[model samples]
Target chain A: GIQVEQSPPDLILQEGANSTLRCNFSDSVNNLQWFHQNPWGQLINLFYIPSGTKQNGRLSATTVATERYSLLYISSSQTTDSGVYFCAVAVYYGQNFVFGPGTRLSVLP
Target chain B: IAGITQAPTSQILAAGRRMTLRCTQDMRHNAMYWYRQDLGLGLRLIHYSNTAGTTGKGEVPDGYSVSRANTDDFPLTLASAVPSQTSVYFCASSGTASSGYTFGSGTRLTVV
Candidate 1:
């Protein structure tokens, strides 16, 4: 089983501030995804980056597969962004998708 | 278009009762997975099906069972529910492992 660890277990940011969340895995992964679990508990897909960098709106993610870690950047954060961000990875031909604990972000208005 | 539909948005069941959570996807993906989410613990996989007719256990599969009779439907069953089984269950599907997953709204289950 691959071990996944997410840094900055909890974060509090003022609206309009920028923050970076990190995820590190123990082994090579075939898939890496960033998800936002809103206050209502819906898992919203953010980015699917196996490797390389991708940007969606004010949010972007970069995964360095060789280093076995991924970074998620949130710029100009808003109150709506207050939620838990999770990083999940699928290793070994996607046999299983393991999830990290999560980075709980609270964007204060 | 409903990407994924989960029945009974929320449920409350007596301990030891049997319940089945229904999940249906219209995208016709080859892989389907069932996961349960708890406070502070994040999401934990319960079971997964690579394709129709094939099922495998996940991190927490005890007391939980899943069946994929076809590509569109994957139902999770609990033989005997317990208080600890109370959590929000999500169903997801993906065309391929690298393509990421589309998740259902989720079913919030409470066992008393």
Candidate 2:
């Protein structure tokens, strides 16, 4: 089994602040995804980057497979962005994904 | 298409009762997974089905059983519920292991 760890277990930022959350995996993976768990407990997909970079609105993600790490960037954050961000990975030749502990964010008004 | 639908958004059950969580996907994906989310611990896999008729245990499958009768359905059953079994359960489906998955809203369960 592979291990996934998230840095800055907790984060607090202002409404217009920018932040970066990091995820590190213990092994090489063929699949990696970032999700935001809202207050309602719905896991919202943010990005699916196995080994590249992608951006969606005020959010973006980059996965460096060789380095076994992924980063999520949030710019001009809003209060709605306050939630738990998780990074999950599926190791090569594995059928299941392991999730990181998550980074809890709080964006104040 | 409904990516995935989980019935009984929330449930409360007696410790010894049996309960089943229903999950269905309209995408015709070949792989489906069941996970339980707890505060601070993240989401832990309970079971997974790679295809129509095969199922496998995940990280936390002690009291959970799952069956894949068809492509669009994967139901998880608990033979006998326990208090520690309380958590938010999510059902997800993907075309394959390396692709992005679609997850249902989730079913929050509590046992007494």
Candidate 3:
């Protein structure tokens, strides 16, 4: 079984500030996704980066498969961004999708 | 209306009772999965199906069962609900094992 760990278990940022969240996995992954669970508990897909970098507006993610870690960047954060961000991964040809504990971000206005 | 749908947005059940959680996806994905999230913990896989007629256990499959009789629906059943089973359950699907995923809003279940 592969293990997943996320850093900065909790974070508090002022609106308009920038922050970075990191996720590290125990093994190589064939699938990886960044998800945001809003305060209302709706899961939103942020990105599906297996081995490269992707940007979605003010949010972006970079995954170094070789290093077995991924980084998510949130720039100009807003109050709406106050929620938990999760990183999920499926190791090489495995059907199991393991999720990290998540980075709880609170963007204060 | 086009993505995954989970029924009974939330439910409260008595211990030892049997209950089924419904999940349906219209994306025609080849793979579906069930995961449970506890308070302050990340989601843990309970079961998964690669395609229709095939299913496999996940990291936390004990006491939980899943069946994929067709392509659109994957229902999870609990033989006897327990207090520890009270958690948020999420249903997700992907075109394939290596493809992108879509998750349901989640079913918040509580056992008494």
Candidate 4:
């Protein structure tokens, strides 16, 4: 089983601020995705960067397979961005993905 | 128009009772999965089906059963509910085991 850990378990940022959330995995993974669980509890997929960089609007993600790590960047954070961000990974093309505890972000207006 | 849909956004049941959570996907994906998220914890996979007529156990499959009789539906059944089974359950589908998934809104189940 692959272990996934997210850093900065809890984060508080002011609106318009920028922050980076980190995810580290214990083994090589061929599939990785970042998800945002919004205030209403909808888990929205933000990125599917297995080993590269991807940008979607105000959020972006980068995964370095060799390093077994991934980063999620939020720029110009807004109140709407206040929620939990999770990173899930599948070990070397495995069928199941293991999710990290998540980084709880709170953007103050 | 193409996504996963889970029925009974939330549910409450008594211990020893049987319950089934419905999940349907219109994307016609080859892989479907069921995950349970406990309070203050991350989501843990309970069961997954690589394709129709085949199913596999996940990290936490005890007390849960899933059947994939067709391509569009994967229903999870609890033969006998327990309080420990109370959690938010999410259903997801992917084109394959190697791709990203689209998740349903989820079902919040509470067993008394």
Residue lDDT tens for model 4, B1-112: 8899998999999999999999999988998999999878789999999899999999899999999999999999999999999999999998865569889999999999
Question: Candidate 4: DockQ?
Answer: 0.74
Candidate 2: segments with Cα more than 4 A from true spot: none
Docking quality tier of model 2 = medium
Which run of 10 residues does model 1 chain B get worst, by summed lDDT?
B93-102
Comparing only chain B with the true structure, the TM-scores of all models are: 0.98, 0.97, 0.97, 0.96
Best by DockQ: 1
TM-scores of the candidates are 0.97, 0.97, 0.96, 0.97
Model 2 clash pairs? none
Model 2, B54: alpha-carbon shift in Å?
Answer: 0.6
Q: Runs in model 1 with CA error above 4 Å?
A: none
Model 1 CA lDDT for position B49? 97
Q: Tens digit of lDDT per residue, candidate 3, span A1-109?
A: 8889999999999999999999999998988999999998888889989989999999999999999999999999999999999998888664567789999999999
Query: For model 1, how does the per-residue alpha-carbon lDDT over A1-109 read when each residue is reduced to its tens digit?
Result: 8999999999999999999999999999989999998998888999999999999999999999999999999999999999999999988666768899999999999
